[model samples]
Target chain A: MAICAKIDTYEQMYLIRAFEERIAELFSRGELFGTTHPCIGQEATAVGVVTTLEPTDVVTSTHRGHGHFLAWTGDVQGLMAEIMGRATGVCAGRGGSQHLYAENFYTNGITGGMGAVGTGMALAEKQRASGNIVCSFIGDGALAQGILHEAMNMASLWDAPILYALENNLYAMSTHVRDTLAGGIVPRAGALAIESATVESDDVFDVIAAAEQAVEYVRENSRPYLLELRTYRFCGHSINDERAYRTREEEDEWQRRDPLARLAGALAETERRAIEGRCRARIERAIAAARNAPVQDLGDIGKGLWKS
Target chain B: MEKLTVGRAIAAGLRKKLADDPTVYLLGEDICDPYGGAFRITRGLSSEFPGRLINAPISEAGVVGVATGMALRGLRPVVEMMFGDFIALAADQLINHAAKFSWMYNGAVSVPLVVRAPMGGRRGYGPTHSQSLERMLLSTPGLRIVAPTPRHDAAALIGAAIDDSNPVVFIEGKLLYAAEQATVSEHYDIAHTHPPYPAAVLNNAAGEQPNVTVVTYGPMLPVVEEAMTAAFNEDEVACEILAPSEIGPLDTALIGESVARTGRLIVAEEGPRSWGWAAEVVARVVERWGDRLVARPVRVAGRDLPLPTARPLEDHVLPGVETVRGAVEKVMLQ
Candidate 1:
C-alpha cells in the first residue's frame, strides 16, 4: 500500500475508536438507550477489510457494526444522529444503532443470524456479474449458527464471490472462543476444502494483507474464502455488562496491542501529530453536527419501517 | 370455460407463469421429479420447466433465504413451504430479512419474492400441519399476505404476487385445493389484478336486501356458505357471503360498507380466535362504522387447543358450517 493509503487507514481506525469511545461515554450517561455492542478493540479488523475493497463493493455487518459502517461508507454525523434516533438519521431513526443502513453497508441489529443473508447478497452480486464482491462481517460467536454453515456450503458449492471475514474477538459476550467453538473456526473452514487464513487483527496492515488476498481469491475464482481475525474487545459486551468473566491482566495485555497506538507509533513524529490533530478535528466536528441535529418524531417512525 | 379445482388451478397458473417468464422459478422440498409436491400441486411441473423447478433439501430457512437472495437479484422466485406450519422454521429469513430488507435498505432493494404455504385445517393433519398462519404473517410489515378462496382468485392472486415488487406470503387453503372450482387461463394477463384488500363476494345467494352478511376466507368459505344456506332454509333468514382474496392491505372500505348495508356481520376463520384475521376485520369494521352496526360483530374461529389427529375430534375442533350459522343466528338475535 502507498504511504498516503496507510495514513488514511490509520486515521480511519482512530476515528472509529474515538467514535466508539464517545458512544460508550454517552451510553454510560443514559443518553443513548438500547443495547450497544461496541466494536472498540476490533477497529483494525473493520477498517482493514473495508479499506481493501472499493466503495462499490458491499458489506453486511453484525450488531457491533459501527466501526464497519464508518469504515466503509457511513457519515459520522448520520450515524450519531441514528443512534440518537433523529429524523435526519440514516434510517430516519427507525433502525437506531443496530439496524443502521447506509450507502453500501447493511447493519443487522441483535440478530447475528444473518450469515446466510449476507451469503445470499453475495450470490446475487455474483449472478449480476457486477464485478463487485460482498464481504460478510460475522463474529466468532455466529459460527455456531446453522445458517452460517448453510451459507458457507452454498457459497462454496456455487462458487459465490463472498469473503467471510470472521472477527474472532476471543469472547462472545462472556464465553471465550475456545470454550464455545470445537477445534477453533479456521480449521473447521479448512475441513470444507475452503482456503482459510488467520491474521493478527490488532495490526491493521496484517489484516489488510489478509483481506486483500481473500478478496482477490473470491473475485478471481468466484469462490468464498474465510479470514479469521484474532482480536479482543477492550470494553464490556454491552453498556450493562461489567465483563466479570475476563481477568484484568487479559484486558490490559490486549490494550497494550491497540491498533490505533501501533499505527500512530509506526509513523514519524510530525506525521503522527498531524494525523492525530486531523482525527480529533473530525471527531469534534461530527459531535458538533450530531448535537445540533434534530431528534426524530414518532410520525417518522413508520417512514423507513417498510419498503414501498 | 372448463372448471378446475383450486389445486389444479394453482399448478396451471404456475405452468403458465413459468412459460411466460423465463425468470420465474419453483423451489421447495419434493417439488421436482417423481414426487411433485406433498399435495401434488406442482405435479408435472418439473418435466415442463426442467432445471427451473428445484427440489431443495429439507431446509425451510435455506429455501426461503435462497429465494429471497434470488428475488433480490431480479429472479421471480416462487417458494413453497410444503405446509404453513413449516414457515416457523424460516421465520428469521422471512420476518427479519425478507420482510424488512426493502424498508431497511431505504427502498434501495425490493424483495420481489412469493412464498406459497399450504394453510387451514381440514385434512386431519393434526396440530403441526393444520394451521392458517396468514394472520402471523399479516402482523409483519412490508409483507403482502394473500389467501385465495376460489380457483380464479387463486390464479389471479398468484400472478399478482409474482408481478408484485414486494415480498408476498401467498397462503393456499388445503381444503380449497380439493373443493373450490374456477376457470384457469393459460395466457399471462397483467390486467387480471386482485384487489389488495376487501373480501371478494363470491355469491350474494339472496341478491339485494341481504338479511345477514357472512364474512369468510380461505378453506372456511365453502363451510360458511353451506352453513349459511342450510341455516337460512332451516329458518327463514336470507344471507350473503363475502370472501376476500387479499388478506393484507385489507379492503376496509368494502368490508365497512358491506357491514353498514347488511347491518350484521359474522366473521368465520380457521385460525385461532385471539388476534386472528377475524379480529382484524372486526376491529376495522368497528373502528370505521360501529355506530351503523345493527348488532355487535361476531367471530367464529377454531378452538384454542391444537388440532387433534382423531377424525371426530378434528371435525369438532375446526369451525364448521353449524358453528358459523350458530354465531350468525346469535348475532342476529342480538
Candidate 2:
C-alpha cells in the first residue's frame, strides 16, 4: 500500500512537471496568450499538501497555482483548455491562468489575499461541525501583505479549522527572499500563536508526512496551523523571465536535488521510464485538445458579469 | 402603516433573514451585545442568534474578505462596515475578489454577500468617518449598490439585497438612522417599480405634468424631496422625483421616461460633484435622450473638497436643500 501511494505521488509530481514544461514551450512558441507562473521546482509542496485534503476540505491557491490545481483535480484537459483561452476552459477562458475554481478548489492571483478567504471558509465549516478543514497556499512573497497577518490573528482567535501552507521558494519575482522578508516565516506564525512546522526538503514523502500531521492537528483541534515548505524554484518566476538574478551554478545546485529525480530513485528504472512516458503522452494529448478547442464568441462577453 | 426608522427597519430585515435562513450570518465590528454596532442596527441580534452575529475586529478588509469566503462556501454572510468611509480599506477585497468572483469564474459560483455601510455626513464624524464613498464603488460590474431612502421601504430593500445572488453594497444614511422612513405621502402619489429592490416614484397627486425630473438616491432623496416641496409651495413648480433603492444597476428606464415627460432634468447626490452618481445619471440620460430636451440637465452634489470638521464648513461643503432647490429652479427656468 505504501509503495502504491508512493508511486501515485511520483506520478502526480511528474504529471505537473510535464504540464508546466509544455506550458513553457507553448509560451515560447507564442501558442499561449497571457502570462503564466509555472511552479516548476515547487511541485512537491503542492502535490504533497493537497493530496492530504479530503474531498469536503477546501483549498485556496495563489497566482502560481497550476501545480495545486492539477494535484487536486488532475483534470489536465480542462486546465489546458482554460490556459489556452478556449470556450471549453474551466472558467470559459475568462479567468485565464490567475483565477480558477472547482467544487471545493479556488485560486486567486493576489498574493496573501486567500489567507482571509480560507479562514472565513474554515469558520463556516467549523460552524457546520462538518469536520472539514481548509488549506490555503501562499508564497514567501505574500508575507509582505497585511491581510495574511490579519487572517492569522482571526484564525487563531476563532480556532478555525484551517492549514496555511507557505511554500518558501526563496524569491518573490526577481527579489531574493532575504532582501524582501525581514523575519523568519515560521516564527512569524508562532508569534500569532498558530501551531506551525517547517519542512526543509525537496522530497515529496517528507512534505506529505508534514502535511498529514498538520492536517490532522487542524482537524482534530479545530485550530489553524501553518506549514512552511522550504524549497527552490527550478525555473524562473514566469515563462518569459530572463533569469538575470541568479547564477547558472545556483540553478544547477538546486537542480541536482530535483524532487522528481529524488522520487524516481525509489522506483525501478523501468517503472520510472514507463510513468514518465505515460505522463508526457497525456500532456501532449491535452495540448492537442486545447489547441483544437474553439474560442469564445464576442457576443458572449457580458454573459457571466452577473448571475441570472 | 407602521413608521419605521431606517435603522430599525434594517435591523428587522436582518433579524427576519437570520430567522429564515440557517446559512445566514452577520459579521461586523462590535455588532454584538453591549455595543449593538456603531449605530445600534445589530442591537439585540446577538442575543437572538448566538454564534451567528460575529463581533469582528477592526480589520475591515478581513471582515469583508472572510465574508466573501463564507459566501463562496454556501453561507449568506452580511458584513457591517463601522463607517462607510472605512470601506476604502476593503476596496481590494470588494472590488477584486467579491465583485469579480461571479464573472471571473464564469458563473460557476455566486457571492450572496451584503456589506451594510453607514454612509453620508451630518454627525460631525470629520474626514475619515463621514463620506458618501458609493461613487468610488460605482461602475463595478457584478457588484450591486443599493441605498434605502426615507420614501422607499427600507426593510424590503434590505431583504431584496440579501436575497440577491450577486454581492450587494447596502449603504445606509447615518442621519436617516433615527429619522422616520415615510413610505406613504399625501402631497405626492407614491408608486414603485417591480420587486427585487424597486425604484420609488413620486408624482403630484393633482395629476399635473412635472416640469423638471429630479433623480436621486440614498441621503439625497429627502433633500431633493424637501427642495421639490419648497419649490412647489413657493413657486408652483411640479417636479417628479425618482429615487431608486438600487443605484448600481440603476433603473435608468424610469429616469429616462420621466425626463422625456418633463424635458428638463436635475440629478442630485450626496457625493462630490466630479464623476459622482449625479454625473452617471446625467450621462446616461443624455446618452438615451440626446437632442430631446427643453434644456441641459443640472446636477446638485457636494463641493469637491474634504468635508471639514466644523459644522458651518461641513454644511457649506455638503449639498443642502437650498442647493437642490437652486438646481430645480435653474432647470425649471431653462
Candidate 3:
C-alpha cells in the first residue's frame, strides 16, 4: 500500500475546494456570467486520479471539470479568468466555463464528447509510442450515451491504452443514477469484458490506489479499463439549479464525508496545519490574480476564431 | 508526362503524402486489407504501408471522431466516407467538434484533419447515397471546403490540404474520379501554385471579354463545359467557365472578378438550390457587383426534391448539360 502524502495531495484538494467555493461566490454576486458546474464535493476523485498521471499523459474532462483541470494542469487564476470570460483566460474568453479547454492538458468543454475523443487520443499516444495513457473522465449519466459504448468497445478491441474513469456522483442533473442507468455501472464494463473496479469517493487513498493500478494495467497491456468512483455532489448540478430535487439531509451527509477534511485528518497535526496554511495562501493569491486580471473586450470575440 | 485519371492521381498524391510525412495516415471503410476502398483509390496501399493504412469498422461517426482526435494529437489524419451522403452520420463530430475545436480553444488547438468523401450523382447510387452535401459543410464556419475539378487540381489540391494546418473537407466528385484526364508528376513535386486552397480557372474560353460567365465545380464541370462548347458552336456565344476548386475560403475575390468582368453570371451546382454553395457565391457576387449585373445572376441547380431512384427521373432531377446551356442562354439574353 502506497502511503498517502499530505503536502501534494492535500494541497490539491484544498485548492480545488477553495476554487469551487470562490467560483460559487463570484457567480452568486453576478461578477461571473455563464454556466459553471462546480466540482465542490468531487475534489477527491479529480485529485486522486490526476495525481496518478504525469504531465505527458493526456486527459479529457467533462462539463463539471474545474477540479480536473486545476488538479492536473494550471492553477486557479487561469481557471477563474476563464470562468469570467476574460482575454487572460486559458482559452482567451471564447470557452467561458463549460468550454474551458487547453491543448497541453488535452481537455475539451464537451459534455460526453471526451469518451470517444479520449479513445482517439489514446490511439495517437499508442502510435507515437509515447508510453503515455489517456484518462477519459465522464459522469455516470454519460454511460447511457451510445458514443461511450462505441469508444469503449473500440478501445478494448484495439487494446488502446486508456482509462475510462466514471465519476458516479449519484445524480445526473435531477434524476438519480438508478433511474437513468439499468443494472449497475461497473457491471456494464464487465459485460464488455473490461477490467473494472469501484472505489468509494470519500476514501481518497483508495481511489488513488485504484487509479494507479488501472493506469499501470493500461500502460502494460495497452488495453482499456474502467474505474468507477462512487461519490455524491454536495451542491446542485449547476449554479442555477435549485435543491428541490434532493433533500438537504442528503447534501449534509455528503458534506460530512468531504474528502479534503478526511485526507487532512490523516496527516500529522502540525503537517495538516502547515498544508492548510499553504493552500490558503495559494488560494488568496490566485483570487487576487483573477480579480485583477484584465477584462476581455467584446471586439476580441472574433480574434481567436481561427489560426493565422 | 503521363495522363492519369482523377482517381489515380488522388491515389498517387495520397501515396506521396504518406511517404513524405510519417505522421500522415489514412482511415476509412474498405480503405485497407484484402480490398482497398470501393473505388480502389486506396488499392495496394495496405500492402505498401501495412500498419499506417488503417481499415476502420463501418462506423462513419467513429472514424471521423477518431481522426479528429488523432489530428488534435499532432498527427495529420485523412478520413474517407465511402459516399458523401453518408457523411451526415458524422456531422456532429465534424460540424460541432472538429470545426469548433480550434476556435473554441481560442486557437490553442489546431485540428489538422481531412475528411474525404466521394460526392455527386451520375452513377445512379440512388437518393440515399447520391446527394451532394458540400453546401451543408460550406455553411460551417471553421472548415475549409475544397473540390478539385481537373486531374492536376485533384492531385495538387490534396497535397495542399495535407499541408494545411486547419481542418479541411476535401469533396471529390465521383463522376470525375474515373473520367477526367490529369497530368501527374512523380516524387510529390507539385508546387502549390494557388493560395493554399483557392478557386482555379481551368480554361478561359472567352479570352478577354466573355459575354456570359459560367460558374461550376466538381461533377458539374463536364456538363458546364459540354454545354458551353455546344452553345458556342450552335449560337456563336463565347462564355467563360470558372471552377472554384476550393469552396470554404470560397475565393470570393476570384468569383467577383470574373462576374465583374462578364457582367452576366450563371452559377451551377449539382446539389439543391436553396442555401447551396451557389447561394453563397451569388450573395458574394451580389454584394460586390449586384448593381452592375446583366440579370439577377441566375442559379442553375438540382430540383428541391429528394433525388429520385428511377434513371429517367434522376436524370431529369439532376442538372444536365442542356439545363446549364439553357441557363447560359437566358443569362446572356438578359
| Most accurate candidate by DockQ | 2
Stretches of candidate 1 above 4 Å error? A190-193, A297-300, A304-308, B1-3, B20-23, B183-198
User: Estimated TM-score per prediction?
Assistant: 0.92, 0.98, 0.94
Ranking by TM-score: 2, 3, 1
Q: Per-residue error at B35 for model 3, in Å?
A: 1.5
Residue A155, model 3: Cα distance from true site in angstroms: 1.2
Taking the candidates in order, what DockQ does each have?
0.45, 0.78, 0.61
Q: Taking the tens digit of each residue's C-alpha lDDT, what string does model 1 give over A86-153? A: 76778766677788787667777634456676666676676567888888899998887777776687
**lDDT of model 1 at position B231:** 70
lDDT of predicted model 3: 0.81
lDDT per residue (tens digit) for residues B27-132 in model 3: 8888996788988899998899878888887778777877888888989999988999988988888887888888878777888899999998978889998999
Clashes of 2: 0
> Lowest summed-lDDT stretch of 10 residues in model 3 chain B?
B184-193
Q: 1 or 3, which is superior by TM-score?
A: 3
